[model samples]
Target chain A: MSTLRRNPLRALGGARQTPGFGDAGRVVPASGITSLLTGITSAVMAFLAVFALALSLSSGQLAQRWSATLSQSATLRISAPPSEIGAQTAAVLEILRTTPGITSTRVLDQDEQRALLEPWFGPDLPIESLALPRLIEIIESAGGFDAVGLRLRLASEAPGAVLDDHTRWRRPLVQAAASLRALAWFSVALIGVMMAAMITLAAGFSLAANAPVIRVLRLVGARDAFIARAFTRRFAIRALIGAALGTGLGMLAFAILPVAGESGFLTGLGFHGAGWLTPLAIPVLAALIAWAATRTAAMRVLRRES
Target chain B: MIRLANVAHDYGGRALLTGIDLHIAPGAFHFLTGPSGAGKSTLLKLCYGELRPVQGEIELFGQSLRGMSRDALADMRRRIGVIHQDCQFLDHLTLAENVALPFVATGRPVPQTDLRELLAWVGLAGQAESLPPTLSGGERQRAALARAVIMSPEVVLADEPTGNVDAEMSQRLLSLLVELNRMGTAVMIATHDLALIRNAKAQVSARVLRIQDRTLQSAGADL
Candidate 1:
């Protein structure tokens, strides 16, 4: 190809016309360098966006886990005299065994009782010194154990049994987690909207400041789209670079976090499996914001000036 | 070539230019002169398609100015070089780069030798690397001329190119325009300097168009 054919400017123009873009990659008006700072801001925004996404996902997972684990299992407690305690426990187990969704029932040994009390009282305390009720550990099948009917049957056979299904606590826990997920998603959306607005404002200021350049370029026969492309491309690249840096830093921060044994939310707010690629999306988010901001500003400026 | 028929301009309903008829054939050197606020610059802007006429007709190379597209007007601008009284330049660029801005904006590849030659011709060869803000008024005017004519346009419109320069510097700038006219480019200089006009008349047969009362007409035969 001829030397003229090899020019970068023409090659920049060969693609879709970017509004107000001067040359494909031609940095005109020297203000194009501002993108470096703006790009960093965009990257930071993307990093935060990633955190927002993680919060939403983790909250949802927490809701799902709470709903699955606590909704099924229920415990039956029988209090009776020393002579009647074993018989009441046996009757409660018999009722549970015939129940459709009850998977298994087991009576706790004295060692387990001592273990449960170890946190509040000293472990060396004599087990025989206190009166203990018979405690049964009930396991429910997949859907959930029937609490209402089982409680009625246990009441008829054993007068002192109390059925605890965990409905009151489980409902509130799952609701709290679901609400948290919604809030996290709302936060991510708000950040995206703010990023769009910031980019627009920045791009608008850029176009406004470069008024003379635009006039000069226009007078020299450049289309409005040509002038806009320079800005759009610059900001997009800046946002992408900024987003990449931010995402990397965010991930690094996440990596050093205390694992499952340490922090609750912090440990959960990280990319997992294919989620690792989630940070890579930071650059693309920045690019999208830059594109939107630059496009709006470029078109408005071009329309008004042209 | 250009033609204007009863061209009147109004800004917010106040007459800035009224009922003006003027013509300049190809290669003609014309001077537009009037007192401050008499609309000399406004006339020049109208002539060059910067400001559209409010109540008259303008034709450039035989195309109606009223119906022209923005792109079409821009293309016409490339053929006409305009130097404003406040010659704006990208302050960050060196003088050489400023002078070559027209070619760059137009996507015309400017040869390095040609740029150097043009700067040298304007006596700015030594200051080529200096920014516009650092250059003196005289240097800026010269640089502006170099920029305006970088593409070798068919017509040149200068709005007080020598307004801020000394007499000697003014003469030097006038000589550059004269040289360009001699090379077949029509030059219209908007200035209040009769001495410069007379000095230019001695070298080239020139016509004076005086703008007054929003109208343009030839000066009295004596002056």
Candidate 2:
């Protein structure tokens, strides 16, 4: 009973028989050493798969966020002499207010201007001393204002006013994020392939080592499916156990990574809310790979023996 | 039932068995005696569907062996039990488990009470929990016999079953075979032991056939 509890499939009802009458032998011997090694390999591969899944999903989210934030806004830079700077700024504001899809507009205050320059220059640098261009922050409505139309209007109204819609930088940033997301997904797929290959190799090794066992089984009238099931079930269960452990460890690692609080690449590399469910698929996938690998190897060996 | 009509089998380049016409009927007990390397074991293998004849038709349970699929052969094996001289056994399994192997192979659960009775009948009730590697040659032979008849097969084919056991143990094993025969199971035994065949002829009406010069013939008035 205790043995069955530890491995429910070990002394299954199918193998048990009326005592002393028929041979109720275990069709295949328990391959502890090979199973352990395969399990460990599955675990490591699953861990990597989990990380790849997280990275791809998070990067995808990052791409969407960047596209949304950048797509909804534009900026107007007025580079006129001090005398005309005030007049050009007023003209640009009046034109933006009249333009369609311009939800809201605001002129940068002295403090806002200084904060924008703080990254490049010292915080204490006098903002009024240099003849910096006056900047206007524009927020677009859900029906975003047209960049080309706005630029044409500004060209005629205020020659010094330059409309910068940020598409030049936004497109590349979003593309890079999307590419990273795709690369992560590709990595996950590659990991799955490698896991299958490793499992197939391990299963082949096990079959070769148990040649005598197979011979005995065939002599006793055991079929190929029966022998294959013994191996496939053992390997599949091992892969499932190992992958579960690996995924847990992987999730733990992701949890401990430095959070990208405001906006950064690594910040988007972690699972959020229901996204945590994604890594759970890793164990199931590993088990399936193990089943396929072991079954193929067992059947091939049986065929060649026949 | 198994039948071979003008069957001939050959190795890569040499003819092993030729011009063989044989039929094994239900509840029939047959003993195939031949010298070493005279196709006695090969003939036994052919009877069990383990080997195909190179030259004629072989039928098992009314189906031709040439046209049977692998699955069909497996199902056919369920009805025919075979024992080898070397007594192949999964060493990792207990003696009881080894006996119940045929049931496992057929995807059926071994009935524990019946299995216990079978082990006791083979005089190995106490050795049920022992491993195969620990068993003596005689014990292994008895265990193999127990396994062979576990499925209650229609026919049992044994090759040199008593080759490795002592004279006393051989007689005990022969008694078990004779008992199976009385219960309506067809039995075929291929052996080189003339003394054992003489002993068996006294207990059961067994027809003794011998193979020599690549031909099968009845050993008239031998027993």
Candidate 3:
């Protein structure tokens, strides 16, 4: 009844039709199991993704903190005969004071040393009785001291003084933290892949279940794009809702977690400040993944059937 | 309009319909009559682009069915409405929605007044909100008829449209098809009911083509 003159080739190739309210999503009947499966899979995957993101970011922060703290300071351990220990310590202290980048120096008192060793040696141990080496702590300025030059100076002035710049141990720790962060991000990627796979399977099942509905639609002159859009829109919405729930729960879990104080690594594994905004993108990403997965599945199935 | 030239279709590696030349022009009325499994449904499917012939070319609206893309075929189908013998409907949607499906499929706005009038004409005004499963056999057939012509298609191909309905309902459905043909919409109904054919011959000049031994033959006017 429409008087509009249309191109025959364009009509054959399928003209783009504006989607009406009826054409939007109600064409396919919503199945209970497939809907629930898609929602639950997206929610669970997004929840795990949030955890992985937190782990990756926290490990990155831990690596940076360790690198900064370890690079700024060095320790000098003076081990010699009890008669020469005091002279060697004095010599090392003099060399450290004249160093260009040395900001301050503090020698650990007996009580402080005892407290450091209390975890292993017990609080009741007599610190004076044992022939303990004298330890000198060196704090460096913003420009770090040259370890090689300082080591050469200490070896000449005080033979018993060994400069421990913390490189050998710090390097490995920082490397391990960096590796952990990479592994966490890899896990997030894996979770996204798994979500896509699950959504694809669910879409396939839904399409098969709605085979009769599809036949009816096709008989009524519904284009493949219209059918695919209906399915993709439904799946994307379900994923968005599910991911929103999962992300909210993840944020709440982090909120109630024990605050990171002087406590070690496990306690610091959470979002900090503006980093809290990162998880909000998860739902959007999940929706996109669902849309792509469902669209692919629908087109494949429709093409095969065609 | 549909034209089949030297079309031959096979089923399970055997010819079901062969050496067929048929044309359903604009405003033409056709009745395909044959025994069960005589390829009446198959021929209807071929006309609608549902099945391709193994030996000949079919043209719908002057465009060759061969080499047409699926989307192209789908778009071409919008000009030709088909009602299956089983009266397929989306079980979740109401009867009104099913009848207006062509509009929905093409993303066109449903003409509410026309939909209401069509339902009324089909004697289904009260059953607008009823589900397909709840409708009686006669009502389902009438609903299918309404759905088929709702798009104001150039042609309507129906397979055994009145197969499960009563004599009165069959007559009523036939009159609707006749009315549509009078309004310049080509119609083709595939059925085995000679009485319905006789009933239709009185009201409209129709061509009755019978499929016998894998070929089409024009029936005599003895009835």
Candidate 4:
């Protein structure tokens, strides 16, 4: 007992130890390689986590852009006999000039009108070829004029004129974009939950596979902490690897996105300045998730063993 | 070094050992002999804190076993070396890694030269890199002895260390235990082989104890 007291670490390094593998002078530690893999997994998971975060951030941006840009624009158009167009245009300008909080109004020049119609009616066409409707752009102050009230008055005062607040046109577009952004965020949340579940399962299976090894370690007096360290380190590395690969591929795909607003469907979908740095955070977040998962699994298993 | 008084153990409502009393003095070499299922192994388990006695007192190094925290028990275990009948090993690991497991568990590193010498002493110098599954029964027993002594523990408790080995291998393993005894380490061997026990008596005085009807007695003692 006195001798054992002097060498109180016997159980941890006691006999009934392994007798095969490595050289006499340099025996390798069993968990060394496994732990390295865990570290790799941690890095990969962190990489993927950045992308998850990116999706969430972009979703919020999309929602805000929809609400902000869609809330404030209106257009007015006048269709009349060729002789009465000037009269209608003058009457519209006079009405706009007297309205409350009417900031500024511009009558699109013939060139601007031609450019607007250029898509369907080819360039260089004679201006008098068809009964062209006169288009006017309006700007309003912070507390702008009431759109509904103005349209009602316009309908009565100028039968050949119509006021469009652009609300109906922009509503569906913004709603669709907002919904798409929400879906992206939902996908990101699902990925995170999946990553956690996958990592947990992987760690648990690995621990089960190494049951014999764990038993021997315990017989030799290993503590729960020591055993947990090996597995936690190992699983974390695995997650890191998977996440990094996923995040890398995600970035590559994002890079090919058409310029924002270049097309209606793809408009503002890509990241803005400094947003590139946003995705870079995925790997770190992935690593954190891996760390949490492996640590949880390892501790759970070790606690039961001890 | 260890004491068990009126110790009783039960498994699944069946009694394995009942009313057993034994005391092992410090720095003593002793042998426990009994038939299979007579609880020799169970007694060792009780002594090592693996299984608690249902009724009785167990004291290790003069401390009561009851109410001892796991950490405290683990601390106590660190001082004693125990050898199992099967000589369990982490098969995936090499011999050296296996031997160094205790060091690894305790969060310490063994010196390379000392490890080499120990392996050489166990006659497994060439098999250090081999896996546990590839080792012969005798070699594994010797390796176990080496690991037990690695920490230079004061007490060594072995359960049927020679059960799987041939006569020749048994002598070699016994010799290692005797040597450890000569070095002032308390040794306890649980075996029913009288020939081996008689042989062990040749060089040094050893007290023999026996278990009968779940009770320990010193009738066959030969010093």
Task: Indicate which candidate wins on lDDT.
Answer: 3
* Candidate 3's iRMSD: 7.5
Q: What does each candidate score in C-alpha RMSD?
A: 8.6, 5.6, 8.4, 8.9
State each model's TM-score restricted to chain B. Answer: 0.97, 0.98, 0.98, 0.96
| Candidate scoring better on TM-score of 2 and 4 | 2
Residues B90-130 of candidate 1 have per-residue lDDT tens digits of 77555666777766665666667888889889998877666
TM-score of 4: 0.71
Task: Tell me the TM-score of each prediction against the true structure.
Answer: 0.70, 0.82, 0.80, 0.71
- What value does DockQ give for candidate 2? 0.32
Where's the lowest-lDDT run of ten residues in candidate 4 chain A?
A19-28
Q: Which stretches of candidate 1 lie over 4 Å from their true place?
A: A1-40, A57-186, A212-222, A261-268
For each candidate, report its DockQ versus the true two-chain complex. Answer: 0.17, 0.32, 0.26, 0.21
- Best-performing candidate as measured by TM-score: 2
The TM-scores, chain A only, for the candidates as listed are 0.69, 0.71, 0.71, 0.57
Residues A1-306, model 4: lDDT tens digits: 332343354445554333322332222134555545554544444445555555556656766676566555567899999999899889888888888867888888888888888898799778767788998988877677888777777777776888876778767866776676677667666666776776787678777878876666666666666666676555555555656676776677678755665444345454567887776656556666767886788778866663
Please rank every candidate by DockQ, starting with the best. Answer: 2, 3, 4, 1
Each prediction's Cα lDDT score? 0.80, 0.87, 0.89, 0.74
Worst 10-residue lDDT window, candidate 2 chain A: A16-25
After superposing candidate 3 on the true structure, give the runs of residues whose Cα lies further than 4 Å from its correct spot: A1-23, A73-169, B220-223
List model 2 lDDT by residue over A1-306, tens digit each: 333443354455534423433333346677778888998999999999988899899889988999889978888899999999988888888999899998999999999999999999989988889899998999999889888888888899899998888888889989998999999999999999998899999899889988988877777777888888878888899999999999999999988878768767766778999999889999999999899989999999988875
